[model samples]
Target: MTAIYSIFGRISETIEKLAAIHRLLPWILAFALLLPLPQILSALFNDYYIYLANKICIFILLSVGLNIVKGFCGQVTVGHVGLYAIGAVSSALISLHFGWSFWLAFPIGILAAGLAGIVVGLPSVRLEGAYLALATLGLGESVRIMIAVTPLFGSSTGLLSIPAPTIGSFTFDSYTNYYYLVLAAAMIGIYLSFSILRSATGRAFMAVREDTVAAAVHGVNVTKYKLLAFVISALYAGAAGGLFAHMPPGYIHHNNFTIIEMVTLLLMIVLGGIGHIWGGIIGAIIVTIIYDQTLEFYFYQPLLFGLTMVLIVIFMPRGIGGMIDRYLATKKFIASQEEKSNAAS
Candidate 1:
């Protein structure tokens, strides 16, 4: 454990030094390095792995956004899937009905979800704890029910044949081709998440999360920050939805957004470590892979997921990311002690 922490500490220091050269330098290099991921996945495993990668990327976006509200702002929202549904359905409908390109429809879908986020967040002003959870859950379930019953929203049929993005003659209509589009979005989403977490807005959110009354006392405008967290989180969900809707095969059903799905998302953040910066990213990758691998045990999947969440809460309440954070903090403190001892000598 100490060795692992040392390795991570060294790597983190390297990254900080690189970041110091230019704020975006590390991210730019990361983007460039990730550009060939699709080809590499295809080479090592198979084309199906590329599809899984795309799914993971989308989940990354969703989980990260969910973290902003549920983790950062300490708002218990289960209706994030509803915002996701709005984005996917909105984008799909625009492409199917108005014949808009993915480029245009994507942002529109995101906008629609962002608007819905305000509605979902409204209850937070007066609610807390389980009551807030129930309100968000109700709102989320209502969206799924509306989609399931309404023929215009595709109902049981679902929306299909959503167009892929294109750049002139180049069409991102294949899994390999579509990987770049989603990968870029996921990367940008992560970068922005980190940016938000480090900004004054993020501190205000943390203040609100840590203590709503205290935040208000400090002139934090707790209500506004709470709402802003949801809005920002919704934007990420919306972007994820748009991408998922337009992915190859381009079909979206009401079943895609459900209580089970919301639970899975919650598991991601919980397993990764809620409020930790890399929690969503780690949880998304691990859970997505685990879920994909356990597809054959469909009957037991939910049970397995539920059991895993419970176990994690009991044994590792802080999660893998939290453990890592502790290790890093410990390593830093030890180094400082050594430095002081040497100076005393």
Candidate 2:
């Protein structure tokens, strides 16, 4: 019995170590690819691989954006899909109607999403907990209905024939080009978000999240920061929306903004760990890959998703990112203790 327990403990330690490596691996590879490594690899691979790479990059962007609001800002929003829809439609309308290029449409669409976020978020200053969630719940349905009614938004049929993004003279018609485009945008967003969080504004936002009243007493300007958080998050969703609409398929529908879509985004944020940027990214990737692959294999993907979600929430409330952070902190503490003891000797 003792031997069996020891073996199990060893296996668990080994698995945890591997998981840590896996989490850090993506960032390392991303950095490496930005160096001479990508050139070496591209020398061997073809364009098809780039296509799938583009998909993953786009998902990473979407997750990272959603994380800005839900994870970092501590916003319990369930209407992210609606924000995404607003962004997608906004850009689609401009590009479709006026032939506005990516340079113009992308920023415009993001601003539109921000405006929508403010429109919805500005009214929710007093509502917290379930009330905020409930109010945002109405937003998704309301926008969904509006899209259903207006022929300009494609009525119930939704928008079709959305144009691909073109930057200057270059048309983003190929997956490889679009992949680089999306990757660049995602990298910009990730850098800006991390940079913002390290700034006074980000600190104020975090303070507001922890305790609004306490933040106010500290002169953090809670209302201003909170609105900033919402707008930043909406900007992310809007950019992602434009990417989704401009991708290979080059079409979108209101069904893409369904309630489940919003729920899934929130689930990714919660399951990965709230108030953590990387958490949202991992959660999004995990959920997207699992649900996408599972649906391909069978139709009962929801059952598996629900089960996974429940198990994660029940057993690891802080989520995968939280667990990783704890582990890292512990490791560093132990190393510091070891150094201190060695110095004393």
Candidate 3:
């Protein structure tokens, strides 16, 4: 703890200085989020594509959520799909069985999922890296089995006929309306993530991620903050699952937890950048687009994912995000050198 505190104590002034300048950037991000894609949503049948687009937005939100725990906090949680399932089941059961409205249930579902994350976080907090990963994988599997074995969850039959979110009388029935709702949700997730990374907690997460022992010495409550990250990640996941449950053109069969799916999410974060949100964004888009476009050509889907992951890892230790950071570092270094030369001359 002293080490982290000492390092931060030394650099605290600089960090605060940077934060002052960077805080307003969130508004710019808000604007950027609102800007519509000019070329893509142009077709009359683009509604179908918009449907695809909404799915991407959902995945992006999920990826961002996963990034908080797995990427930034240096924790490995393979139980995210379990979190998803929890949220969906919470909301769906309330709506389908109890006759509660979707509106009342959505937020409740998110809270329930948050509680689940905290529960999952408790045991995992004592663990780190591979051990923790395996624990979460086990948890996910357990959750899957519980859902499949229980009649309430419809076992293998699975739950169907979800209600949709609405504002008063206007049903979010159209693809465009649904797109906006999911997009707004996705944007909110991105914004929160950005804010988090810039804040003091984020720096602590990075410190722990880089070296837990060292980070602890610097006064980071490693356990607490790691738990916080897990909760934040799961919060996003729950919101996504809730939205997925309520939104139309809905999922017929909920995805069961698999080692492969967990590995795929890890691949997404690793390929994007461990702590970088943009990495998840990029990874999710690439993975989802390929998966959607190539399902008919089933032979190459897994092969392409494998090839993409292997090639990126070989060439890039930091993945795509790492390379971008390196480039920025190099550019700054060269610029500083040029300035020094200019001053000397």
Candidate 4:
């Protein structure tokens, strides 16, 4: 693990150096590098791996978005899945009913989710702790119930035959072809997330997280920032939902956005390290792979997930990302001590 973290540290340092030349250069390079992943997976394994990769990408967007509000902003929101459902349903409905192209419908879906985010975030203005969680959870579950009961929202049938994105003579109708779309979105999502984390707005979010009263005292506009976090997070969820709805299978059900899915999403962030920037990315990849591997034991999956969350919280409270942070901190400390000793000698 130490060696792995050391390697990641070197990669991060390299990227930081690239940022000296241009901020977007590293992301562009990453996107370019990942562009060939579909072909590579097809060669080494199978197209299924590419499919898995796409799912991971979507989860990356969702988990990372959730992290912004839950981790960075320290808001207890169990209703983010509700916002995701809003995006998916809105996008699918727009494409199916209005005959809109994926390109147009996607952003509209995102807009709808962002609008709903304000409603979900309203509770945070006055509530805290378990009360806030319960309120959010209620909102999230209500979305699923409404979708389940309303035929216009797909009811028990779910939205189907959602159009895949296309341009000119090309169509993204296959898993390999669709990989680029989701991959690009996921990369952009992470880049923007980093931008938020480094900005004055990000600092205000941290301030609110640390202490809402203190943040308000400091003229940070705690309520506005809190709502802003949810809205931004919802936009990410919206993009992810639109992508998921338009993926090869091109279908979305209320079951896909249920509490089980929400719990799984939470587990990803928790297992990765709550406040770490890479927490969602790491957790999404790990949890998705694990869930895929354990598909045969479907009956026990929820129990397994619950147990895993419990064990991680109890034993490895900081999680893998947290451990990596500690390792880097220790390494830096050791290096500084060695320099001091040599200087004295």
Per lDDT, the best of the predicted structures is 4
Backbone collisions counted per model: 0, 1, 11, 0
- TM-score against truth, every candidate: 0.98, 0.85, 0.86, 0.97
RMSD of each: 1.1, 6.1, 7.0, 1.1
Candidate 1 lDDT (Cα, 0 to 1): 0.92
Q: After superposition, which runs of candidate 4 have C-alpha atoms over 4 Å from their true positions? A: none
- lDDT tens readout by residue for model 1, 59-89: 9999999999988999999999999999999
TM-score of 3: 0.86
Give the better candidate number (1 or 4) by lDDT.
4
Residue 52's C-alpha lDDT in candidate 2? 53
**Residue-level lDDT for 293 in candidate 2:** 59
**Which is the winner by TM-score between candidate 2 and candidate 4?**
4
Off by over 4 Å in 1: none
Q: Which sequence of candidate numbers ranks them by lDDT, best first? A: 4, 1, 3, 2
lDDT of each: 0.92, 0.73, 0.76, 0.93
Candidate 2: residue 340 lDDT (0-100)? 100
What TM value does model 2 have?
Answer: 0.85
Those runs of model 3 whose alpha carbons end farther than 4 Å from true positions after fitting are 1-45
Q: How far off is residue 154 in model 4, in Å?
A: 0.7
* Residue pairs in collision within model 1: none
